[model samples]
Target: MLIDTHCHLDDPTLLASLPEILAAARGAGVVKYIVPGVAPEGWDGIARLAEEWDGVCPAFGLHPMFAGLYDEILLTRLRSFAGRAVAIGEIGLDYLAEVPRERQQAAFRGQLRLAVEAGLPVMIHCRRAFQDLLAILREEHVQRVGGVMHAFSGSPEVARECIGLGLYISVAGTVTYRNAVRPLEVVREIPLEHLLLETDAPDMTPEPHRGRGNEPAFLVEIARKVAETKGVTVEEVTAATTRNAVRLFRLS
Candidate 1:
């Protein structure tokens, strides 16, 4: 069985058709999904989905894109929601966007502390800010509860850094694109034992399916590409990644 380690199933576009989407995912051999929240507003919806679906797990946190929406008041609310979540996540830096770097840094650090305090793993969302993120993680001594780096698009060196901190590197549909040499390279370089697969559904659709709305079902193509890159069978990739997901999230 395959596990989608990072996906936003709570997005309205996808959530509206839950049964069909989940059926398609299961048809593709995707037996489990970890749906990480994008903002405080999305936490409840994600949690509710997890409660309703046997294979879905919830992760709550403020995404970097919505960092400005977070405030001190949300901390208590987050603590309550996180109690039911598998991890604290979809949180980190996004230098690719216009959000002020300092503000994003503050928000990321705050959530990191929250995850540390809650004693939960983090599902990070980093983009073009690996060095800064790594520095902050180091400073915070945030190695206690390492988690997955969602949609990882960094160099093998950066992947090593994250692995050093006990974090897993998740490769998404981006790896299926022919132009995604860097991501593919990282996939080959990182050991399968530390790798996880994701689709980042409703986005990052793999080749031949590009321009179409992505779904968990497309994770098969991502896994196929990873298997090819690593010179392993699809079953091996699926088994290793599923094992990594269960171990990382402490899922049953």
Candidate 2:
């Protein structure tokens, strides 16, 4: 079975048709999902979904892209929610976001500290900010609790560094794209044990379904691509990645 380590099932598009979507995913052999919070307001709904569904796990945090929405009170609220969450993220720095570097850093650091204190793994999102993200993670000693780099879009060298830090590198639908040169390289270079798969649902749609909203069912496409890149059977890819996700998220 496959576990999509990152997917925004809380997003309105997916949430609206959750039963049908989840059934389709199960048919595709994608048995579990990790739903992450991008904003404080969304945390309650994500928590609700995890409680209501069998294979849905919840993670809470503010996305770097939503840095402007973070505040001290939200951190307090996040702490209260942490005990019920599988991880404290989809959090990290995104240089491409229009938000100031300082603001993003503030939110990232705050969440990292919370993760450490809460003893929960993290689900990080990074874009064009690996240097800063690596530095902050090191300073925070994130290796203590460990985590996964959501939709990792980094170099092979960076992938190695993240694994060194005790983090799994999650590959997304982009790995299936014909132009996914870097993702192909990363998958080839990284060991299967350090890898996970995701769809980033309602976005990052894979080939033959690139224009449609992505969902957990499409994770099979990513698994197939990773298997092709690593020269392994698709079952091997799914088993290894599912094991990796269960370890990171402490799935039952």
- Candidate number with greatest TM-score: 2
- What TM-scores do the predictions have? 0.98, 0.99
lDDT of 2 by residue, 1-252 (tens): 999999999999998999999999999999999999999889999999999998999999999999998889999999999989999999999999999999999999999999999999999999999999999999999999999999999999999999989899999988888788999999999999999999999899999798889999999999999998889999999889999998989997
Segments of candidate 1 deviating more than 4 angstroms: none
RMSD of each: 0.9, 0.7
Global CA lDDT computed for model 2: 0.94
Q: Score candidate 1 by lDDT.
A: 0.90
For candidate 1, write residues 205-229 as lDDT tens digits. Answer: 9987998889999999999999999
lDDT of each structure?
0.90, 0.94
After the best TM-score superposition of candidate 2, give how far the Cα of residue 177 lies from its true spot, in angstroms: 0.7
Note the clash tally of each candidate.
0, 0
RMSD of 2: 0.7
